[model samples]
Target chain A: MKYLFSVLVENHAGVLARVSQLFSARGFNITSLTVGETEDSTISRMTIAVDGDERVMDQVKKQLNKLIDVIKVVDLTNVPQVERELVLLKVNATRQTRSEIIEIVDVFRSKIVHVASNELIIEAVGHMIKIDALIKMLKPYGIKELARTGQVCMARTE
Target chain B: MKKTGSEIIIDTLLDEGVDTIFGYPGGSVISLFDTLYNFSDKINFYLVRHEQAAAHAADGYARSSGKTGVCIATSGPGATNLVTGLATAYMDSVPMVAITGQVASKMIGNDAFQEVNITGITYPITKHNYLVKDVKDLHRVIKEAFFIARTGRPGPVLIDVPSDVQKASCEFKKITNVEMRSYNPTIKGNIKQIQKAVQMILHAKKPIIYAGNGVIISGSQNELKEFVEKSGIPVTMTLLGLGGIPTDHPLSLSMLGMHGTAYANRAIQESDLIISVGARFDDRVTGKLDEFAPHAKIIHIDIDPTSISKSVNVDLPIVGDAKGVLKELNKIIKKCDIKNWVDYVSDLKKKYPLSYTKSDKVIKPQFVIETLYDLTKGDAIIVTEVGQHQMWTAQFYKFQKARSLLSSGGLGTMGYGFPAAMGAQVCNPDKLVVDIAGDGSTQMNIQELATVANYQIPVKVLILNNGYLGMVRQWQDLFFDKRYAGTCLGRQKNCKPVCAGPDKKCPDMIPDFKKVAEAYSVKGYRVDDPKDVKSVLKEVISIKEPVVVDFRIEQEENVLPMVPAGAPLDKMLEHGLS
Candidate 1:
């Protein structure tokens, strides 16, 4: 099973290294991770996606909380939540297929952020399934390169 | 008041009620040492020959006194030397604060001289670590180091301060009250969980309390004793938990696990319920996890939640300090009726008691320990280096009090005992501190003889010189076909360089520890005959100075009642191949 954890830690040097080291040393698998400064500059929040069962994740959660830099850990998997990932795709586009690609982007509610004679860079932001669907829609045009900002999540307000 | 980082560090040490510090001077730590000179009246410093000894000494001090031990070393090699010591303390959950000096802040990443990422190196081994790039963080970092090191599941915490930070003066404000949003340890067990534990204890017919060093760490032996008496449960302790319950107590089953008593193992395997308190089910304690205590319903009580089910599955877990939980359980729990179970286990004990070949012709290591135990009346603080002798001391010495037996149980570091005895001796000036060492392990940190001689620290180091690394040799004899490769410590005259090599230095004396001791201006004694063992140990132990008594016991002797690795505890080899 895959588990998502929202970890709050001190925003300073070696914090990320310590967090990642804990996973690596313990043989836990990190599927994807995204980290950035929180509202307060002194604190950082990391959304870590891990692959483990209930027992392994239980250990992961407790071990993460044991770190001095970590403030709190919340497993957002069971909570009513919203998750989003921003992905940019560069597709091979000839003059003949340019309009068709734009039409597909418009249908998917994405944007062509960059354009060239040989390529069209499109940006899409949505849930993981929606992003996958957009990529599936764009893959036929020979997707040149792609980059993803791993998933970020928040609990839905009551 | 305005003070430099060095001054703040000394002030913090004093504020923490620290009277002694173990450290080694180096290029980067010179400034700190200079400030220490001026504050010598407030605090005392012991100069260790090696940084590793400083760390072990601090560990010994911490384990003996229940106070966080402090050690300081410089960067690079000095910091690296403390690595083994830190791991030793970390494994045993000993409270220690280790401070390392780094190169100036600007040269931290430039690969400057005497600079190392100590905080990075000690990440896994330490409970927490900090590298203070700024002088202002020094005071708070020092305080936090002490607090974290002494908190629940106590462990070593290192503070790597750059040289520039130590020299930089600032208006130091001591942090009187420390409350961290991230770091808070649980002290009290959950009421529901305690109730569940009580219910489980009441229902189980054959219950045994497996205690560990946590009983001593929490200073809850009295509480544990009360719980044991009230519950009427037999107790089996780990190697480090020898003193948790007095060895002579009717309910105490001595020690358990690998190299433990055969009866204790039998009891655990046959137990219907195992009430584990303050003890991790280490691989050593649990042989062949699938086969360990096959019939036991485990209720683990530990402060660390992760340790509860990390290795062994538990039916009930109460996460809190052992002393606190034991107290609560005692208040609510009633006496158990396990008279039949007790009789069965007691019969097992009689059937499989610890045995050794009695010989007046050769000195037996077990006999040496028993004599020492009788002479000290089990009142002395007994420390041991890891080997056959360590196991012998753990077996023969009937510890009567908590914090009375100190050794490297988790890491099993060989060189830990002698220097650790120094720290124990320093803390308890009147109590007799003895290091039951082996010939191979004692030489690891033997240069500490210089420190002991200079300060006249009366630490009796009893080296069971069997002329070989006894424990490994025992394993080689049992499992490795008795080839005896690289295990021999002494060689006869006219030895060939073919197998030992030209540079191996297989000397006739093997540096002859007695001579080594005498050169260091310490008294030395040797006992080759079994008749001389008692008189020599009694005389040497009474000396008010450092003494090394080399007891030349029968070579090729092995510690018995041994369970081979990966085998179930009950399937133990009672006697060596004669």
Candidate 2:
């Protein structure tokens, strides 16, 4: 099963490394991790996606909470949550295929961030499923480069 | 008052009631050492030969005294060396605070000399770790480190201070109180859960108490004894729980698990109820999990909630400090009339008593340990290197008090005992401290002899000098058809695969331990004759200096009453190839 944890930690050096190390050393697989500074500069928020059974996920949550830098950890998997990911893909394009690519980008509500003579850099932001779908659609155009800002998640307000 | 980070560290340590520190000096920590020089009257710092030994020594000190052990080292390699020791303490839940000097703040991440991300590296191993970014935070960090290290399910904590921070001056304010909202640990068991546990105990007909290192960690030995006596239950200890109850007690089954006693294993197998206190059902203790104590209803009392139901399912789980929970349990539980169950366990004990061959020509390892036990009257603090010798010592040495038997239980780390013995000896100079070590394990951290000789610590190192890595050799002998692949420690380069037995001629042992001891300027003795065991042990124990006694025991011996991996505890091999 996939579990998502929203962890708020002290914005300190090596905090990210510590979180990643905890997962790796304990043999817990991390599907995706996104860390960024919160409104308060001294605090950082991390959205970690992990794959494990209930027992393993429980251990991961407990171990993460045990870290000194971590202030709070919330398992957002079972909760009503909103998750988003951003992907930037550079695809090879010819004059003939450029119109087709733009039409597909319009249908997905994505933007052509950069356009070159033979390449188009497409930027997409949505839930993980949508981002993955857009990437899958662009795969046949010969992806020149790709980068993803792993999933960031939040609990839905009641 | 204004003080440097170094001064704040010293003042805080003194305020925490820390009198001794184990450490090694390096460039990054030179300022801290210099500051320590001025406070020699308040602190006694033992300079270890290696940083790793410093950590082990501190762990030993912590386990023996129930105080948070302190060790310090420089950044990079020095800090890295402490990893194994920290991991060992972490696994066993020993309370220790390790202070390491990091590179200057500006130099961090620039790959400067002596720079390492120690805080990041020790994250998984430590209960909590801090990197002192500002000198003002030094005092608070030190206090938190000690508090976290000593409180609830204690484990190692690391504080990494950059060199610049140690030298930087800040307005020092003494922290008289520390309250971390996110870090409060549960001290008392839930009332409903405790009631459930008591109910389970009352209903149980054949009940057993399984104890572990937490009993020693919480200093709840008396509470545990009272609870067991009131409940009239048989007690079985883990390796770290050896001294939780007197080994010779009528209801005491010394140890249980892979290398545990036959009767103890049999009782665990047949018991209807198991009351586990402070013990995490480790894989070593639970063989073939599905078949482990299938008939038993488990009531687990542990300080750490995660440890409960982590390995084995439980009928009832009480999360609280062992001492607190046991006190509550003793107050509520009544004496049970389970004479039939008690008699059945006693019969099992009598039937499968621990025994070994009485050899006249060769000294068995068990005999050597028994002699040591007899000479010390089970009073000496026994530390051990992991292997056959460690198990034998745990089996033969009857520990009558908590914190008397200290070993790397969870990690099963080799080369832990020698330095650990030194640490224990330093803390208890008036008491005897001995490291019962194996030939292979002794060689791993043998350089600690220099530290012992330099400090004049009266620690005894008893090396059971079997020619092979005895435990692995035993496995190869049993399961691998005696192939002896890479298990022989002293095999000659040109020696035949099928070497002659001990009765015939065989290659001599390498790096003779007596000579190795002599090289470190310590007294050394070698005893090959079985008759010399008692006298040699007595002479060494009487010595006022660190001494090494090499006992050339029978080479083909293996620890018996052994339950093979993934096998049921009831199925034990009583003898070697019997």
Candidate 3:
């Protein structure tokens, strides 16, 4: 199971590394990790995605919550979460396949970010599954390049 | 973003998840103490009789609870007093954070009355230490110190807060995270190395697994057992490694050192392959390195890289977490033929097992310890005091699980048992917690009986009442001519004299342990007869409240299988392979 947690922590050097290190040292698999300053300059919000059993996830949450710097830990995995993943994929599209690729991108509401004589760069923003499926579809079309902004999630109501 | 000193210190502690601190009040740390008092409702403070006890209590809490233990002390003597406790935690790798009060900024290094460079003194033992000179940096320094203490190979970390800094006000900003490039702990085991280890185990005809404290510290008992079960290797544990494998398990050989089982010693000597996990080849275990497991091809696994090849040489050294490495090794070891190796080790066990002779002259400490095993069946956790009693308990008591035998193994702290037992009981309330102490060692921390009584902590204490310092006597008996020196309890310094005859006027100062227990309003039982010792221990441990049993025994009994000072493991006498 995957868990997405947004933690509010005191802004101090090494705090981010501390969380990541805990994950790495414990052998917890992290699918995505994003950190940035919050509205309060003194506080930083970190979104971490981890895969583990329920018990392990619970322990992880409690352990992270026990850190003195952590003000609050909000698990956004189940609470009507707004999850977004951005991908920039360059696919080989000659004259024969260019029109078909454009039609597929239009169906997914993606935009053509860049275009060359034999390649097309498509940018899409959605949930993890959508990005994964898009990557799979583009693989058949010969993906020339790929980059993904690992999952960043927030509470839907907030 | 900057904060004042006092708030920052509290914030850092809060960040470190410290809810309880054991400490003593003093001059230099008055401000910190005052702040602590104000925050009393939120952060708990346990007042201790001495600074040393505070440290031990913290260590006890950390060991059982699996959280960083916190202790606070004032400057100079208070700080110095904590050295023993810090060293104990450091040696055992307990996660602890010590807060000390330093002299005022201007007063420091002026030959200030209460000022001492605590950080310098604790440098060698601590995982890391800091002296917070500036108030603004207090919070960050404390947060970072806590981070270092509890992470990687966990150990104690100290922070000396100047008195003035505790008074200086700062903003209450907390540090939520910490990142240090040089501090990353290695997590993954090298696949190639693990595969090689598997291959060695498969081909070896006679292989034995030498387990150590590393298995317990890494929390990898399951992994160790899995590896052993799959590889069919016989396992021998060190004194500290006793509980890493269930002692009753068919392949489990209780301990492998000075007093290790005969089968374990023979297995190590004759085995073709040796797998040492999370244990250093201490002189006690490897008497003469050249003769120690000379026939075995050694494979050493530990989280600390330096531990590899430090004492005995290693053919295959895997540098990673014991649990992680064992997990990887288990996967690869699944396809191996270790049946012959297992049978060879089992044959050794059948030939020369761990059996002791019952003495006809006096009550042996080993017998009393074995009684503890009979009563508890190695189910309860056993804590012990230093001196001959500690070694005897390690030799005689059978430990069936890890974290079950909590003693001052590395520091050999004499007064450890009573308080440590009390602490262990706090963590394991339902399980029976017993402390086995020598007469000399028990008196060192007997004051903690009050703590045990006050908390209503049902800790069973078995004081092996041998009137002399037994270990010292053993050394004298071995090295010096049997002309007794000051090792006797009737010495002038101790202000006591034995009643030898009717005419002899004995010193009026012998304190009866039963009376002492009565004074504390705790139950006391005395076993004068050797025959009744086992029944008395069973009754005491079975009770619902704290019970102390003083079993007076022969004075000169020594812990056998001892290697003389600077002797090698294979050179151990009294007991070993034929």
Candidate 4:
């Protein structure tokens, strides 16, 4: 099962190495990771997507929690959540196909962030399904490049 | 004044009251070393031949002194060199803070020359580690590293500072508190478990107490004594457990394992109840898991849960601090009588007391160890390098005090003695420290002789010189049809074309250990007479400076009470011939 976890750690050098070291050491597969300072300047929030058995993830949590710098860990899975994945797709756009691409983008509520003589950059933010659908529609137009920020999720309500 | 990372690192070390650091210099750490050079007037540094030596030396310093020892290295290979030492400190729970320089931040992930993931490599072993990317975090990280290293069930911590971080300037701020939620180390034993353990000790008819490294690590000697005396249970310690109780105590059986006293091994085998405290039933002690103490209802107490019943079955397992557990065990066992049990075991100890025969009447390694124990009266801290010398020291030396015998128990690494002895001495400077080393093993870290001399640390080195690799030869003699293949450590392997000693050209080069000692300007002597060992040790220990006593013992002598690697602990063969 895949679980997304947010960990707040002391913003110190080598903290990332420590976290990645823990994951690699225990053989836990990290699908994606993003770390940045939170609203609290001293704390860095790390969003990590990991896939493993429940027991292995539990071990990961317990071991990671043992680090002195790691302050807290929250599993964001199964919470009434708004999960978002941001992806940028660049595709070959000819004058004939430009209108067709715009029609496809309108259905998915994505925006064209950039345009050039030969290409158009389509930016989309939604769940994995919404992003995958956009990619499928653009694939026929010869997608030049694809980059996706792996799943980042937040709780739905106050 | 705005402090650089280099200054912050030194200032924190100074605040921690660290007086000594073991290290060698290189380019990445030069600025830090430069700062150290400025502070050299106050702090002492021991320049070692190898960074590994510095690590082990720091380990030795910490284990003995009960303080966090420090070591430093340059980037890349210098940092990697510290890995073995850091792991050693980590395994033995010695408090050490290893400082290493890294390439500049921009150069880190670039795989630039002289860059390695030192912090990454040490994650599993270190209690905690830090990398100082900026000067601002230096003071806090250094303080935190020391606090974590020495606080509870102490272990090594590493701080990797990039070259830029070390040189970068920032304001100095003192950290008064560190809030760590997940890093809480339990300091107290569980009351319920303690009471249960006490009940088990108090009610048992034939209880044999087994002590391990935990007893010394937790400083639970007094509690151990009270429980043993109150319950009248005889105590037998593992190799790591030596000195938890006085050797001459009626209840104390020196050590229990393959070559353990016949009585201690048999006592556990026959006991109705066994209270094993602070020890994991290592294969050395539990020979054949099924046959080991089958009759005994076992109560195992240890701090680490993974250690309990991991190898042998246990009737009761308690996880908590050894000292806390001992205190509770003492409270519950107010009074008890095991006169018969004590008497029976006492008889076994007296009759077959650990004794060996030296057929040539030459000074035996056992003789040197026994005499050393007698001379020091077991008050000296005895550290040993691994292999035959380690086992021999365990068997022959009587440890009458706790934390007095330090050796590589789990890892059993060779060259552990000299550096570990240094650590032990650093912990308790008032006490004498001795490193019992073998010729081959000592050579591995023999370079520390300069460190000892430089610091004027009075750590005595007793080299048990035999021509061949004794332990391997013993196995070969017993199991390999005496082929002696790859076991002979004679000069034939690398004979000297010409000798350098008083005698002219000789076929062999026996590591002029005395000359090696003298080269360091330390006192040295070779004891060729077995009869003179006692007086020599007595006279040597009287000296204030570090000295090496190269006692030449019989060549083929093997340590007894052999369980032959794969054999069950219960079925240990007492002697090679037997």
Q: Please tell me which predicted candidate would have the highest DockQ against the true structure.
A: 1
Q: Which parts of model 3 have CA positions greater than 4 angstroms off?
A: A1-158, B1-4, B335-341, B359-362, B492-509, B575-578
Kindly list the per-residue Cα lDDT of model 1 for residues A65-85, writing each as its tens digit: 899899999999899999999
Query: Residue B555: error of model 4 in Å?
Result: 1.3
Which ten-residue region of model 2 chain A has the weakest summed lDDT?
Answer: A59-68
Deviation in angstroms for B569 in model 3?
A: 3.2
Measured over all alpha carbons after superposition, the RMSD of each candidate to the real structure, in angstroms, is 2.4, 2.5, 17.1, 6.0
TM-scores across all candidates? 0.97, 0.94, 0.74, 0.81
Across the candidates, what are chain A's individual TM-scores? 0.95, 0.96, 0.91, 0.92
Residue B103, model 3: lDDT of 91
The collision pairs in model 1 are none
- Model 3 / residue B563 / CA error / Å: 3.2
Tens digits of per-residue lDDT, candidate 2, B1-578, equal 89999999999999999999999999989999999999999899998888999999999998889988999999999999999999999999999999999999999899999888887778778998988989999999899999899988899999999999999998988989987755878889998899889988888888999999989888899998899899899999999999999999899988999899998998999889999999999988988798999899999999887797888888898989999999988889999878999999899889888989989799999999999888888898999999999999889999999999999988989989998998899889999999999999998888899989998999999999888899999998998888888878888777786743343556688888899889999999999999999988989988999999999999979998798999888777888556
Reference-based lDDT, residue B377, model 3: 92
Off by over 4 Å in 2: A87-125, A133-147, B518-521
Per-residue lDDT of candidate 4, residues B328-436 (tens digit): 7776676656778788888888776777886346888888887787777787888998778888899888788877787877666787788777766755678888999
Model 3 alpha-carbon miss at residue A50, Å? 47
Model 1 per-residue lDDT tens digits across residues B110-224: 8898777888888889999999988888898888888899998999999998888899999977789977888999989998999998888888988899999999999999999
